[model samples]
Target: MLATIQKQQNNYVVKFTRPLSHSVDAVWAVLTENGKLQQWMSNLEMIDLQKNGKMHFNMNDGTDAFEEITITDYVYREVLEFDWGKDSVRFELTTTSDGSLLVLQETISELTNHTPKDLAGWHICLELLCDLLNGIVHDEFPMEQWRKWFVEYELLVEDVKND
Candidate 1:
């Protein structure tokens, strides 16, 4: 589903809420464990799993380069927030009666032409994460799906901006 976007004070907040038929622990592992994390988000790796710890964004450009991301907040299986450029990304998990609910929020300092691109990328990553949790895997990114989402997000962003 498309995430809800809103202008929050000086910044814009994009929030995606996903209800998954998996336990909180299972979903948490995929978000935190390097092995499982690679299945969905290959570039991000949790080098230190604590508040103020670090995660690395691998360049993946054949140059073993990486950008260090600081863990702004961490609370075991419940919350994880980290720096994302001038903004920040946060993941929160909660147990449901049947499974779990995952909330991903990205706080954008400013919306630019590239904002929709980042939102679409994140939308695809969440879809991939859901597939992995459901025992399905993809060897490569579904670029076709991303292209479709990018257009949708572009429109969505414009609507939010007008509001």
Candidate 2:
């Protein structure tokens, strides 16, 4: 399944799930390593995939905007957990009848109100992942799509808050 944003538990959640023919090791390698991640995701550095390790992303303008990310839990080829600041996010992998199922859940913190931005970012990221797995090297930044989605998301959030 492609990544999507949902309202859950009074907060926003962004999730992606897919079944792949690749081995769990291969998937984990792509997700944990910096070079491999950049193949699909952004050019991110300072990512430590081990438990209690720190992970941060670099901005487009070469500035380091640090987030207090911690790898809270990890089990080889099975589960990975981390934090986006105080928010908890997890990646769970499971063996399915066909191949492997990968699920990513990003929980938004109540203190933050940037659900629209988060939704847009995740939509692009998941699209990139789909392209990467399919061996397509196309640029996956959906800037126009993100902007459109962000507007709708913000409107929805406002409607929910007022109800």
Runs of candidate 1 with Cα error greater than 4 angstroms are: none
Question: Could you give candidate 2's per-residue lDDT for residues 87-118 as a string of tens digits?
Answer: 77788888777667888888875624676677
Instruction: Report clash pairs, candidate 2.
Output: none
After superposition, the stretches of candidate 2 with alpha carbons farther than 4 Å from their true spots are 1-14, 63-68, 111-113, 151-163
TM-score (C-alpha, index-matched) for candidate 2:
0.76
True-structure lDDT of candidate 1: 0.96
For 1-163, candidate 1 gives per-residue lDDT tens digits of: 9998989889999999999999999999999999999999999999999999999999989999999999999999999999999999999999999899999999999989999999999999999999999899999999999999999999999998888
Score residue 31 of candidate 1 by CA lDDT: 99
Q: Please give the RMSD to the true structure for each candidate, in Å.
A: 0.6, 3.2
